[model samples]
Target: MRTRATVAAVSGALALSALAVPAAQADDSAASYPDVAKVREATSVRAEGEPYALNVSFSNVKIAKAVKVGTTGRVSTAVTYTLTHGTDVNIKAADFVTDAFIYRGSDLRPDHRLFGDKPAKCTATSATTADCKGTIEVYPAAHELLNTDAGTWRAAAEATAFNGQDPAGETFDISKVGYKTQANRGTTLVQRASKLTVDASPEPVKKGKPITVTGKLSRANWDRGTYNGYVEQPVKLQFRKKDGDTYTTLKTVKTNATGNLKTTVTATEDGYFRFTFAGTTTTPAATPAGDYVDVR
Candidate 1:
């Protein structure tokens, strides 16, 4: 959904602001929406519509990686928080509930909501304060789900309190009751996975004959649940002699539109041939097992 760019300033080392959600909704694709700006500090945030006064503070927000590429890799982060109730209210363990989630867009208006909401463990630090901890898991498919483009995203926290010990207990209209929302502006990056493979033919070739080495270069395509070719990327062809442990680069080759690699080398002795790839910002480096060739 599209959000209006109204900035709200929060007090203290932590910063939390609300972005107004307009009636309009933006397309799911990251290409369709503008990148959300990064928030450097933790901001204070207040939940709307709750009759009781509550304060949610976020701190020590640790994101596993600034950029994550594939399904094989996950966007992970741990967040810590303290919840304090007003003088009139008292909270204990399990009396209040909190959830942690990641969002892209503005504070109030998010174009994409990722890493489904999971509960945070809250422990009582005092009669009115609770210290809570939780995590966010974003996989490669998450990128596809958000239609995320390579860029930075935001993190948010939400909390709910029951009028009594049990939320399901009959007392007030559960549907009508509102919860508190606390958000911190930290950025995490998402990218694609890069992969490579190699195979050498004519395992027992006569010495001095040409040996053909073939390989493919590909990247994770979450949309397809398969790896697609990463065309035009440079790959290094290396060889290790049977008597030696060190591998020496023979030549540099580039992938074609289909990410295929084929080259020929003269057979001198029993050795192993392999391909290596240098990764990019949006992709992680990957290498397959070496192909062995036996020469007589």
Candidate 2:
């Protein structure tokens, strides 16, 4: 009887141990799992002569592992984009290129590039869409490549419409259409490093006083070593008194190596002044143009 009782106790202990093994293994697996999520593209559109507006959303967002990365445990998310002409204009979709870049600290890195397959026909009744998609794969070594201690990441999408085969020659239209990413684990997703805007301030220059108006055309991701893809052109600056008034030619100055323009305007009289910055690749309507300052 004693031997049977000992045998029974040992058997019960073994069975309990077998049941606990899987639970222990499950806890370990859960601890080792990495955080994964899906991302989407947000878009904004502006008419040629209208205030900038956004009709942003997402479509066909999918998440999976990147087979090229060679890590089955790693994962990536891909999102597709579509474009259409809201007006009657003949535009080639192939003339545009989509870019995807990753931000690490103050440095922005180009991760992917996609060119349009063919020219899109835009007519009064014509509408078109293009697949602008990107993927971010999560790997064990991804942190090393990105070099972020907080494990935070940021991304942006831009469309550049070209007129010629030269990538850097003439740009007809450029706009930032989309930006998205996962919840950043850091203080802030990398801030927009490059921004191009027209500025006209401290106006009412006395005639011959050399009214200095500085217009900034700045960029953040330009690789300093490779000149950040800098191009020189004679940008024209036009000044006007009112929104509907005809613009008076101020000066045409050449962009420096860094794409900055500083000009001095001698005000003939005290009146409202507006300025426009026109790049070589800018269209008459799409270029940066806005009211500068009101002369009192």
lDDT of 2 by residue, 1-296 (tens): 00101111333112111111122122222111100000011111122321122222223323221112211234344533343333321233233333232333332222321111111122222343334454433332322121122223334333333222231225312232222222111221221122344666556434546566655554322112111212365556776665546766667766677667677666555444333444221111114555455444
Deviation in angstroms for 31 in model 2? Answer: 28
Model 2 has an lDDT value of 0.32
- Global lDDT of each model? 0.57, 0.32
Write candidate 1's Cα lDDT for 35-116 as tens digits.
1111211112333322332444555455545455565555556766666655444344233445455666677655455532
Runs with alpha carbons beyond 4 Å of true place in candidate 2: 1-194, 198-201, 220-231, 270-291, 294-296
Location of the lowest summed lDDT over 10 successive residues in candidate 2: 33-42
Clashes of 1: 7
- Residue pairs clashing, model 2: 93-120, 194-220
Model 2: residue 291 alpha-carbon error in angstroms: 4.8
**Model 2, residue 242: displacement in angstroms?**
3.1
Q: Against the true structure, candidate 1 has what lDDT?
A: 0.57
